[model samples]
Target: MKSTHVLILLGLLAACKSQPKEKETEAPANAPKAEPIACYQYATAADTITLKLVNMGGTVGGALIYKLKEKDMNAGTIKGTLRGDILLADYTFKSEGTQSTRQVAFKKTGNAFIEGYGETTNVNGVEQFKNADSIVYSSSMKLEEIPCK
Candidate 1:
């Protein structure tokens, strides 16, 4: 009788040891995730400049439309990385009916993107912004953010 009681007690102890304990804190499985942000910016009526970009984790992908007075329009797709409110990208566009690629940069201020001052280079017979600085806000060049519809 004593041996049977001891065995039953040991079995209960083993079973208790094998059982999992309830966690004091647990996260829900259906938590919502963060979504990427997208924005559209355009210049005022004085200039024909438009930019649309989707920013995910400081990486920017966008399109740029530059329509200057008496000049051929530049419609381009931009792919670049953003660092601390600065976007550096390569723009591939069609200007004067020619397809070309160039480097461009923009500085974020408030809800506007100011064109960064930079030097231009001829790449494959196309002009491009090489290295840039965020020191200049050219006339009718600042892109103000508008609601993307």
Candidate 2:
């Protein structure tokens, strides 16, 4: 009788045991996808600026092309860290046949990136400007987002 009771108790305990959870092998089919990268361009009489950036959260990284007549035409890369609505990055490019680097910032409004206020970067004794504004975009020469093909 005692042996039978012990076996019954063991059987009851085993029946009440919880099963191990199964791990997820893959993401759900209905999971949302990430946003695609965006491209922007700014044109003026003196310069033309183009940027192809991918924003992950608030951080930005992409290609930047800046060209200014008699100043510099640079095709460099940008790695931006966000502060407020501004994306600040160090721009390194080949300017006037010479390589140089500088600090540049942009402010995002809607789908546009207006100049946030660039001081000056010395690139072989030359300076590059896409707009006349010392700290922000003026009435003209704004950086607007362009559709990618």
> On residues 52-116, what C-alpha lDDT tens digit does candidate 2 reach at each position?
87665556677888786776577998866767666777677776587766667777788888765
lDDT for predicted candidate 2 compared with the true structure: 0.72
Candidates in order: C-alpha RMSD to true structure: 10.5, 10.2
Query: Which regions of candidate 2 deviate over 4 angstroms?
Result: 1-35, 44-46, 56-58, 118-139
Model 1, range 13-106, lDDT digits (tens) per residue?
A: 9888866777856546563333344554565555577788876444577788888777788898887888888788888998878898877778
Residue 130, model 1: lDDT of 60
- Backbone clash pairs in model 1 (N, Cα, C under 3 Å; residues 3+ apart or in different chains), count: 0
Q: Candidate 1: minimum summed lDDT over ten consecutive residues — where?
A: 31-40
In candidate 2 the C-alpha lDDT for residue 68 amounts to: 64
Q: How many steric overlaps are in each model, in order? A: 0, 1
User: lDDT at 57 for candidate 2?
Assistant: 53
